[model samples]
Target: DIKILQLSLRSADLCIESGTLDLSLKILERAAVRVERLEIFSGDDDVPIGRTLSAKYYMLRTLLAWHQTRPDLAEHMLCMIPEEAINNDLQLASELADLCYNVGQQAFSKGQFDLAAKWLEKAAKHNSRSLNAGDENSPNVKLRLIILHMTVRAYLEQNSGESRTKSLQTLEILISYYPNELAVLILWLEVMMKQGNPDHRIFYNRLETLVHVIELTDTNIKIILSYIQKLQEWSIEMCVRTLEQLLLRMPVLSDNEQWIDRLFVISIRLSTSSGVADSLSLLDAVATHLYDYLMKPLSQTTANASLIVRLGINP
Candidate 1:
């Protein structure tokens, strides 16, 4: 019976190849019935064989749906395909990734961003699974990056705080893997500004450090300035702290004429508009307290130290 089913599957495959989709569909329906029957009587040795047959059956159905231009159905069939089947077959995995990406794009174009993000994330997962050990510059890597970028875009287009938070989480994961990635860093900063959080001073410090390492393009400079503008409006003290931190790193960033000029302009604005001269003492006091807490040893001036010193007199 299994042999008969195998032959039937081959016939169905050939019918599909010969462009007889109707015939192939009929044969596949029969094969699907037989697959269910096989599962019922499947023994230990027949289990893998049964799974292989089921995988082929699902794959053929997916292809048929794709051929008919029914992407929604095709995606459904692909979802039914077992993970073991996909992992064992590179071609199947590639097909899955391609179809998911196309479907995601279609959804994105129709303004269904939530659906788009779902499929795009699927595409990214499958595409990344195929990465080779030394293929950093390979086409697959580039494709994965594009997929992830689109995923983030889809999440952001919803214009809700929840969606922006999702985008930030995605960018955070991306930055962990590609720390010096210019686009990821810029997008991360943009999302931070959109979130309107005043606790982004640490991230600003990180940005200053990144500038010393990665060359800032004009676009990067523009986004950084926009972020600063928003931060200044929201919390001038944070903006001042961030500017001071960047100023400390000026020895390295000063080589960029555009950046240095912008930094000086911002500093002048702070000095002129914000009474930065008067607040210098307050900032200095806060800085000293932080420095002493972080740098100075507690044991040196603690009661424990006095007790230890007095022990020698007692003994």
Candidate 2:
């Protein structure tokens, strides 16, 4: 009940701040009833209410009473509550975490890393605990935890090398367990590249394994291909570098051409429909290299002109 009142107060505060006075008043009035129930339940005994209950009511009342005159006090009180208390109340925990996450992201965008770090960490932790409270082994829960850890690591990277290393290690372990996890793999590759470690060969080897898995499975090849294409679209440097290396190593021209054509088509569609052109030059470079190596000299011969034309390109 007390947790419900806390939620009501939070909503009321938001409504008031946004000038929805009617909604705010209704929520506040409902919260008042909950507060009265809390007081009655606690009774006139010398003993106090449970710590969690007290904290909930305190947070609700303090937030409800917030005004310009005592804004600092309210803020301080709000911050004083232990974040762990939120873990016991899942609904409130999720709401508060989301609010903090949004505020943190805005602060990050505004170049307030210190402030952003504090709020984002809180949000991540709350979400993590809420997820963990249920099934720790659930795929969705694990993914959320990975995201939270990643967010915290990003914030800590600016301040501590140890934190960054630890986060990277955690990601490495996760990828080892879930090799098909493309999102985690992408971030792991980025982190490895950023570290500038000569041991990056290991990550490349893992990537090769992933590609082989896609080839073997045939069932999700399209999905796996889409992931690779997204990675290429993410950056020109990555696209050029990865494709160049793949072309150097892979002897199967037909397979490589199929993959390249898919990525190129996707890029063109993105550019035409959304006006978001990225790494087109890189695509052109790879395509030019492939065409020059596979088609140009062949097209120079009269017998091969028909072959080149059959491949849907001008000879």
Candidate 3:
């Protein structure tokens, strides 16, 4: 009976491959009936046999759903297969891993972030298991890290308490893998800020060290400016300190337009909010710096005009 059921399923597979979905469905239905009858007739209750048959059945159904362009149905069918069954079949495991990543990306593009996170989490698990963890240079390992990063982003977009917590945990794993990576560190900083982690100052210091070593590129500048804005709400004192450090290095920055604009806004806002002498002094310093920047070119023009006047042609 078991052999008959397998042959019936194999016939269904051939039918499916030949694009005879109706015939395939009929054969699959017959196989399902046979499987139930075999259980009754054999009286052995072969759980492994049943599970293997079920996995094959669901996988074929999933393939048919794909051929029909019913992605929703395909994903549903895949979910119906038990994990143990998938794990027992190497090909099934590989197919599931790839499918999970694709579906996760599709869900993310559709703004279904929670669903994206769910699928991507599965992809990460499969990829991590298949790839050697210690081989950081492996392309597959890099892909796994990317999947994990996407998972973090998906959880972040969901922004629920549970999702934020999940994002934070994923970020921690990513940071462990690439400790000096700017994007991951910044993301971690944001999640910690949102969670109101009291230990943020430590992380902030770590970010500061990384950025300083990397030497104030546009990317670094953008993240620092973005962060200091948010940090102001948490601690104005720390915000001022960071701004001071940035301002001290102003001459070294390649592009200061955005920096100067936001710095002015932040300085004015903080000075207004605190209404204290120290805040006002910081504001004054910012104004003076801005004046120097704006006036430097004018001063050069003035010097050129004075030289022309002294040449004294009176034409």
Name the candidate that leads on lDDT: 3
Clashes of 2: 0
TM-score for candidate 1, residues paired by index: 0.59
lDDT per residue for candidate 2 within 105-212, as digits (tens), equals 655666666656666666666665556444657544654545454464555456677666556665755575556665655555556555644354465555555555
The TM-score that candidate 2 achieves is: 0.48
Model 1 segments beyond 4 Å from truth? 1-71, 90-95, 131-141, 160-165, 209-219, 233-262, 277-315
Q: Encode model 3's per-residue lDDT on 112-179: one tens digit a residue.
A: 89878987987887676556446667666666667888999999899788987888788878888777
Model 1, 158-183: lDDT tens digits are 88888877887787677776676667
TM-score winner: 1
- Using TM-score as the yardstick, the better of models 1 and 2 is 1
Higher TM-score: candidate 1 or 3?
1
TM-score each candidate. Answer: 0.59, 0.48, 0.54
Clash counts per candidate, in order, are: 0, 0, 0
Rank list by TM-score: 1, 3, 2
List runs of model 3 lying over 4 Å from the truth.
1-72, 79-95, 196-198, 209-215, 232-315
Q: Give the lDDT of residue 36 in candidate 3.
A: 63
